[model samples]
Target: MLLGSPTVTREAAVWRRRLGGNPFTVAPYALSCRAAFRAHRGSFDARWRRLQQLAPLLSSTAAEEGGSLRFVPEAPTCCQAHVYLRGDAAALDAARDAVLRERGVRVYSRLRGAAVGPEADECYFELTLGPRHLEVADAVYVGAWRAFFAALAGPQPGGRKGVGDAEPQS
Candidate 1:
C-alpha cells in the first residue's frame, strides 16, 4: 500500500503510469506477513530496540563533526538513519565510496524530494543497523562514521581542498 500525502501519492501514480505499469502483479499475501511477523517477532523487537539505542548515539556523534554532517530528522523513529553532508557532491561521493571500499560497510547515498536542489552543495546518505550489525559493537559503526567525516574534511590526492578547508559558499 502506498502511504503519503495526496500530492505525493498522485505524483507516484503519475510516475507509475509513465514507467508503464504497476510493478506488482499480485498483491502480497497477508497471511505470509502475519506468519513471518509471528516467527520473527523477537528478532524484530531486538532490532528495533537496538535502533532506538543507536539513533541518539549516532546523532551525538554527528553533532561532534562541527556542522559538516547531521542527522536529517535529528531523532529518527525507524531502522534507517539519514545523514545530510554539507559539502561538494563529488567529494561526498568519493568519501562514500572510500568508506564502503575500505571499511566493508555500505552507506547508501540517495536523497529524494526537497532534499536535493541546485542551490545546495549537500548529499544525504542512509546508515542502517541491520541484523548483521547487531552482531557487532556500536562503537564500530560510530568509528566508521567518524572516519568518513574525516575523509571528507581531509585533503584529496590531487590537492583539492576538502570541504572543511574550502571557503563557505554564500
Candidate 2:
C-alpha cells in the first residue's frame, strides 16, 4: 500500500494505533514505502534520514525507538485516528466504486493541497494521506514536539514557550 520501504513503517503504525486495524498488513505497506525511498535515494542512510523527518511529523502515542522518542504534541482530530484507502482514484462519476475495500474507517475523503514528500516512488506516495495538522496542535502538539525533541536533545527550553491564545483559523 505504501509507495516507500520498511522502517518508514512507523508512519503506518502510528496510523494503525490511531485507526485500529490489522497492523501486520499495514506493516508491509510501510516497508513498501521505504522501498520506494530506496528507489529514489539509491542509499540507506539518506532514506533513513527521510524516515526520521517523517517520524517527527507524527506524534507517537506510545514509546518508540526503545522509548527514546516521546510523543509530540498533537491536534484533537489528529489524535482521534482517521484512516482509509481509496482503491480507485480514476473513478469520476458521482457514485465511485472501490477497486479495493479497506476496513475500520468511517469515511474516505479526498485530501486536497499538495503534500510534500521525498520524490521516491510516485504511486506509493498516496499511502501518505493524513488530516491537516490542526490549530489545536498549537495548544498541544507543538508542546509535545518540543518536549519530545528536548528529551532527545538534552533539556534546554523545558516548557518555557508560552502558548498564547491565538484565534483558531478555519
Candidate 3:
C-alpha cells in the first residue's frame, strides 16, 4: 500500500540538491505509483496489502534509523532512494543474494524489476515500479521486499566487487 499521502510533482525542482533542499517530491512519486497500482482492483488491491505488511518485516533489520537503507521514490528525477534495512555485513550480503535468486523485491513479484547482490558492506538494488497497477492512495512494496530479503539467505558472488558503488541493479 502507499506509504502515505502523495508528493507534489511541480514544474520546478521540488528539491534543490546544490542548495540542499532535500525531501521534496517524495509524496508525489509514491502517490503516482499508488494510483497506478489502484487501477487493477482485485489483484492490485491484494498485492498492495501484502506489500505493505511485508515491508516492515524486511526493514526491521535496518542499521541506521534513516540511512544505510530505505525505499526509493517511484517518481522524481532529482533524488534517488531505497527502502533500506540494516543488519550485519553478512546479513546484508545474504539479503542481496536472496533477491537475485527470487527475481523480485523481497521474495516474489512486487514491482517490475530485478534485485542483484551486494558490492561489499554497501548493497545496491533497483526497483522500477511501472505505471500499470499503481495508484495514489496506496501501492505495493512488500512483494518487492520479499525478493530483497530472500537474497540474504546465501553467499555473495566471488567476482562481484563494488556492489555499493555500482549502478542500479534491476
Candidate 4:
C-alpha cells in the first residue's frame, strides 16, 4: 500500500537552518528535483486557454490583480514544478500544497530560490511531485508543466530547459 507523504520535513527544516537559510549550499547534496519548462510554440489564444485551465490549480495573487501569470518552472530537476511569485513565499507554498493535495496530487517543497530579474529574491518555490515510487506523478508534473508553458508563455524551441532532453534524473 502507498504510504502518506509529507510536504516538508523536519530533516529538511533542520538542514535549512544548518545552512543558515541559504537554499544554495556549497555541498549540493542529492535532492528530489523537479523539471522546469518554458513556453512552447503555440498560438496566443491557445496559450490563453491553457492559462485558464491552470488558473484555478495554481495560487497567484499577481494573476488575480490583473497581472500576468508569472509562474515559471526553471528548476534543474525533472520531477518537480517550480513557481515564482511575489509576496509571502511561505503562504503561497502552503496554498500550493493544499491546492495540489485537494486534487490528490501530492507534492513537496524542495527549495526556495532567488530569481534572476525584477522578481523577488528567494521567491521561487520548487515542488517535487512525489517520492521515488511515484514515477507516474513525475510524468504528470512534466506533462502538466509543459502544457502550462505551452498555454501561458510558449516554451522556446529545442524542448524543455534543464535536464537537457535527458531521461528523467534519479
Candidate 5:
C-alpha cells in the first residue's frame, strides 16, 4: 500500500482521478518502483549514490512503453526514487518481479485511467523495511535477489553483459 504524507496521497489521488483509475490498480498503469532507505544508517551522500547506482538497473528493466527514475519528497531519511512504466500486465509484472528479485526494492504499482471504468484490478504488494546499516535496506526476498544479481553479474560470450541475460529468479 502507499504510505506517505497527505500531499503525496493527494497527488496520487489526483492522478488517479484524472486518469480514471488508480495507477496502482490498473493492469496497464505505470510501474512505480521506490527504493526507500533507512534514516539513521546512511548519510545523504551515501543514499544518493545508492539511488544513482540503482536507477540504471531499474530503467534497464522497463518495458517498450518506456520508464524513468526520479527523486521525490518522502520521509525525512528515506531515499525514495520511483520508476514509472507503461505497458501490459505481463510486461509490468516482469519488470516488477525483476526489481523485486534483483534488489528487493520496495515497489508500488499505481495509476488509474479515468475512463477505464470499474474493472481495474485492486491487487498489489508492499514491503516493510527494517533497520539496516547499508545505504538501502536489504531486500526481503533474499533468494530471488541473490539469484537475480548473480545472473546480472554472469559472464557473457564477448565479456559484455548480455541484454536480458538474467532470468526471473524463481
Candidate 6:
C-alpha cells in the first residue's frame, strides 16, 4: 500500500510514468550472491542484537517522562521502535527541532496519513537500531532519546504551551 499523502503519491506516479517504470525493480549487481548474503546476514544480526538491547532501555526512559513505547506484534523481528509522546504534531515537531539543535542528534517524528491505516495522525517518533548504531554506546542513544522526551514533557518558553499540556493522541 502507498504510505504517503495524495500529493506525494501523485508526484511519484508522474515521475514513474516519465521514467518508464519503477527504478527499484532492478537489483544491484555490485556484489555476488554469496557476498551479499553474508553482508546482509551480518548486518541483520547486529541490528537485531542492538534492537534487543536498546528497546527496553529506551522504553523505560520514555516511561519515566510520561511517554511510552509502542511495539507491533512483530516487534521481535522489527528493527525499529515507536515512542509515543503526550502531545500534538506541533509539539512533536518542536521537540524534534530542539533535540536536533541542542543535542546534535536527529529524531524522527512520524505522521502517518489516512492512507496508511487507522493509526493515521498519531504522534510518535521512530527509532531504529541499525548497523551504524551498533557501534555507538547504548547510554549515548538512550540519553538523547530521554532528553527528547523530557523536552516534550517540560514547559515551552516564550509563553508557548508545551507538549505536556496537550492530551495524548492515539
Report every candidate's CA lDDT: 0.65, 0.33, 0.41, 0.41, 0.42, 0.64
> Which parts of model 3 have CA positions greater than 4 angstroms off?
1-40, 62-68, 72-82, 85-95, 98-170
Assess candidate 1 and give its lDDT. 0.65
How would you encode candidate 5's per-residue C-alpha lDDT over 10-60 as one tens digit per residue?
898888788787545764433322333243344655555555544444434
Residue 163 lDDT in candidate 2: 23
lDDT of candidate 4 over 11-118, digit per residue (tens)? 666777887865565234324222212232233344344434443444443343322234454322233345555444454445444435334443334335545436
Question: Can you give the lDDT of residue 169 in candidate 6?
Answer: 82
Badly placed stretches (over 4 Å) of model 1 are 2-24, 27-41, 109-119, 156-170
Who wins the lDDT comparison? 1
lDDT tens digits, residues 11-124, model 3?
134434445544564567777877755764455444454445434444653322222444443222322224433445555655555555444433322222224324233434
Native-to-model Cα distance after best TM-score fit, residue 67 in candidate 6, in Å: 1.5
Query: Model 5, which residues run further than 4 Å from truth?
Result: 1-41, 61-78, 89-91, 94-170
The true-structure Cα RMSD of candidate 4 reads 19.0
Q: How many backbone clashes does every candidate have?
A: 0, 15, 52, 9, 14, 0
Off by more than 4 A, model 2: 1-15, 42-170
State the weakest 10-residue window (summed lDDT) of model 2: 92-101
Model 3 TM-score, all chains together: 0.27
For residues 29-145, write the lDDT of model 6, one tens digit per residue.
Answer: 323555755766668767876777766776677777677455442244666655444456776777777777777887664644222323554455566665677788877777777
Q: List model 1 lDDT by residue over 31-119, tens digit each.
A: 57777768766676567668777777766776685435565566656666666667666766666666776687544554432336333
| Tens digit of per-residue lDDT, candidate 2, span 23-114 | 57568877888877566444444434333444444434213311222112222212222222121222211111121121112122442212
Q: So what's the TM-score on candidate 5?
A: 0.29
Point out the worst 10-residue segment of candidate 3 by lDDT.
72-81
For each candidate in turn, give its C-alpha RMSD to the true structure in angstroms.
Answer: 7.7, 19.7, 13.1, 19.0, 13.2, 9.5
